[model samples]
Target: MESILATMGDQLGQMLVVLGGALAVGFAGSGSAWGIGLANEAAAGIMTEDPKKFGYALVLLALPGTQGIYGLLVAVLAMQKAGLLGGGSVALTVWQGFGICCACLPIAIAGFYSAIWQGKSSAATILMIAKRPEQIGKAVILPAMCETYAVFGLLVSILMLNGIKL
Candidate 1:
């Protein structure tokens, strides 16, 4: 039984690493898409009332997209660390695979939820913009503040991926 468990871990290591990368990309992108969709919906309502605000409203709608991009970046970095890129494969121990997966979690979790909340903030900013067009500068800042954590997550994931030795 012990031998079987060891073999299972060995066999599953590479797959787990790949799965981690996939999860990072998938969750973050999905969250961004949902958040952007929500913000866009609100923007559409505002657009109907005042078409002149399209450009301003779009700025807020686009804010959540950064998290998805960050996710993709982290996925790429994770894949590279896993040696799944550049047509070169490296054999990873089960523990290494587990490390990679663990490293991905910070960005995956942070990016997913941060984007949703950022979208909410953006939507609220959009509302503020609708009410006070002159306050557009202040409106953009509100959503941007939520982005700080996603950036930190991306940084940590990068550092963790870089630190892992195949």
Candidate 2:
């Protein structure tokens, strides 16, 4: 009975860790998709007005995509940390698994929100550049501002993952 219970506990821990990885990837990836879609809609409109603006519009459309990349990085790191990426698996305690899950939340939440807002910002910038193409430089900076939070979240998640002992 004792051994069976211990095994169950270990399995539960592993499940939690996997859940953490899923949350990191799922939330961030979905957010990026939505963000890209939002920006694409705006870019399509702008491009219709002047097909020459494609180059400038492409840059803005790609800005929100970085958050998804950041989320994937975090998820990969978490999986590697948990030994799930490799053939072997770590025997994590329930507390350790929960901690890992919590650690992933920073990037998961920040990436989701920042990407959506950044997309909105990018859409507005796309419209602005439609009129004054020369201002593309300054316009890029506006959407880039929203990226700062996503970067911070990624940083915190990395740091937290590093701090967690296997």
The C-alpha lDDT values of all candidates are 0.88, 0.90
lDDT per residue for candidate 2 within 1-166, as digits (tens), equals 9999878887887777788888888888778888889999999999888999999999999999999999999988888888888659888889998888888899899999999999999999999999999999999999999999999999999999999987
Q: Any idea what lDDT model 2 has? A: 0.90
Candidate 1 per-residue C-alpha lDDT over 1-166 given as tens digits, one digit per residue, 9 for 90 to 100: 9999887877787888888888888888887997898888889988999999999999999999999999898888877877788857778887888889888877888899989999999998898889899999999999899899989989999899888887
Which 10 successive residues of model 1 have the least lDDT summed? 7-16
Predicted model with the maximum lDDT: 2
* Estimated TM-score for each candidate: 0.91, 0.94
Q: List clashing residue pairs in candidate 1.
A: none
RMSD of 2: 1.6
After superposition, which runs of candidate 1 have C-alpha atoms over 4 Å from their true positions? 1-11
Judging by TM-score against the true structure, name the best candidate: 2
lDDT of 1: 0.88
Number of clashes in model 2? Answer: 0
